[model samples]
Target: MSAQSTATERRRIAISALARELDGSNPASSAARLSEMLDTPRQMIVSADIDGLVSAAMLASVAPSWNVVGLVASSSKWLLHPSVSNEPPAGLVAVDLFSLNHDSISNHVVKYGAKRPMLLNLRAEWQAWDAAVAVAAQKRLFAVPSIWAGTQGCYDDAAKADSSKWKYPLGTAQILLALLEAADRPPKFFDRHYLPWLVANCDGGVSTYTKYAANARVWWAVMAGAVGPASLTEQVFRLVDGMRPHDFLDTVNALDRERQASGLDPWLNDDWNLANSQATTIERCLRWLADLTGWRDPLLGGIDSFAGWVEKPVKASGAVYIGGANVTTKSTEAAAVASLQGARSALNANFYHGGFSGSRFNWIGGW
Candidate 1:
């Protein structure tokens, strides 16, 4: 289905009605009803990984007029990102970027206080942080879904605690899905986009799937037309399990298989940043995956590996480096670099429940 970049006055009225039905008090409930199909067209920036590609693709599938403009590593990375511009990028949207503000997110430690989680037109309201910060907010942005009640014991309260009872870095795609589904824009042919929902809905896909499900249900899920090969996500996980799952290396094999099975181009080969980033993206992806899964395994009654102290060697590469700072590696230290872009107070990102970047195509900003 082709989605035009238009929403009727009645449509906008309808969209608004559902979200603030009550104040934006609860994120999951609020996000489920969130829709930013405003009259304004958006230029979106997303992460450079396979998930970002999928998030962009799914969003395009629904919000056709919104442009999938650029890519970055995490949401805060975009604040000082060269892409942060002075004008024309009127409606900036960020998708699939990790937004949790804490680094070294160990046990249920509230290293920071929490932001009152609420819903907003993430598509319409997002903005860059014009300042340096060790950790950007929005992690645990959504309260845990009740389905995974087991986590309630640790998550005790989302409104006041910044530390997570448990953390899983996947599932932005799923949270996006829940948004569309709630907005009366229910998706179709999404079963083929198996990775989003499966990695999100399934128990092991994320931690405390129930309590965490409440967290934007992700950074967020959208059902593309099909779950072409839901198993592919897991297979891709295992394929890159021991290695860095960067630049869609995990997906390359899966997409290649799909290409051989069907003649489609797998959609990712043409990604704006994929070609240049493949060099270093994989190694970084694998290492992060390894670190996360390593600690997660022991928590889930699996074998202990390195007791979580095995730090991977660090190197500077665009995949992890953002604006001269390492955002992912030594995550806690990857603060937003002070901007040379003058004293423009960054806009308050209206849509950041959990969300939205790629390449230096001279692609400094996302206009």
Candidate 2:
């Protein structure tokens, strides 16, 4: 099928799943359901383009009705705007902070307390944080907590005690969100400092790591576009060539040995043993460096080639005549080619085929 057709089919599948979820159907009904629903795996769907769906008027929320036994009603229109290409989506709600400021609940109970009102308020803030997360998820936006705000259990010990005493980090989610909202257009580029800061601070899981890495690349590409290729070349070189080749190779070999001793396939257990994300990223940086410098570096080229081999299958099929030299023999190469093609087709049918290099070609070597 053509790329456009494939994308259209994917969009249809995604929207249909959203519709079913709105209809109060569970997403775990079957394998097809899992494939269609964005939220099934939770992790993968969390960072999907939820804003696009909302803009398309495809999302709705079900709220409990006033009558206890009555069915829930759909209320609250959900809409989202992508502030930055790299930042998570934010929700907008117009509340009268002025009214709350003079209210009995805010003045008597919240502001001035005879007992530990701060703790109570903090608890309420925590609840609000949870609600915000839910809203963000419903909109299919990234739900990143403030680094210093203590949401999702990410905060310093002292800051967690009192909401009023919340401390802010430089690269906190709030800052990023604000930047995203302030920008007139999607932020495709970011400073080098921001990239490392994000990587070092981001929480790790497959989705979190993937998003962070993707954003970093986006920033790199943007910077390269603005300043010219020379600066990007330096940055890419620093990232890839800074590491010692011996150290990386030794680490991979050691891991392989350990996996062999444990009777486990290193490729399955530890992706780095194969052409994993780390290896792929490193190779990509090297290739970008080569392109920038216009010089063929052996180390970078070698690693790039090795990574490709690891990512792609090595297929060798040729017939050998078993009859004596005096007798003529015929071998069928067409059968071998057909068999290989069939296997390739089967692999393409599976999700996430062709390994990291194939899927992430831009990052790997093609630039």
Residue-level lDDT of model 1, residues 62-133, one tens digit each, is 664655434443322321222333332444454543223211111111111222212222111112221122
Q: Residue 187's C-alpha lDDT in candidate 1? A: 39
Q: RMSDs, each prediction?
A: 17.5, 27.9
Q: Which tens-of-lDDT digit does each residue in 1-367 have in candidate 2?
A: 2323333333333334322322213443221221233222111001111111111111111111100000000111111121211221222111100011110000000121111212343334334434533443444322121211122222212322321112111112212222222221112223342232222222221222234332233222332233233433224323432444354344446645755786743232232311222434334433432343232332312433433322222122212111123111124334423332332211011111123232100000000
TM-score of 1: 0.38
Q: After superposition, how far is residue 58 of candidate 2 from its true place, in Å?
A: 28
- Stretches of candidate 2 above 4 Å error? 1-118, 141-251, 254-367
Global CA lDDT computed for model 2 = 0.23
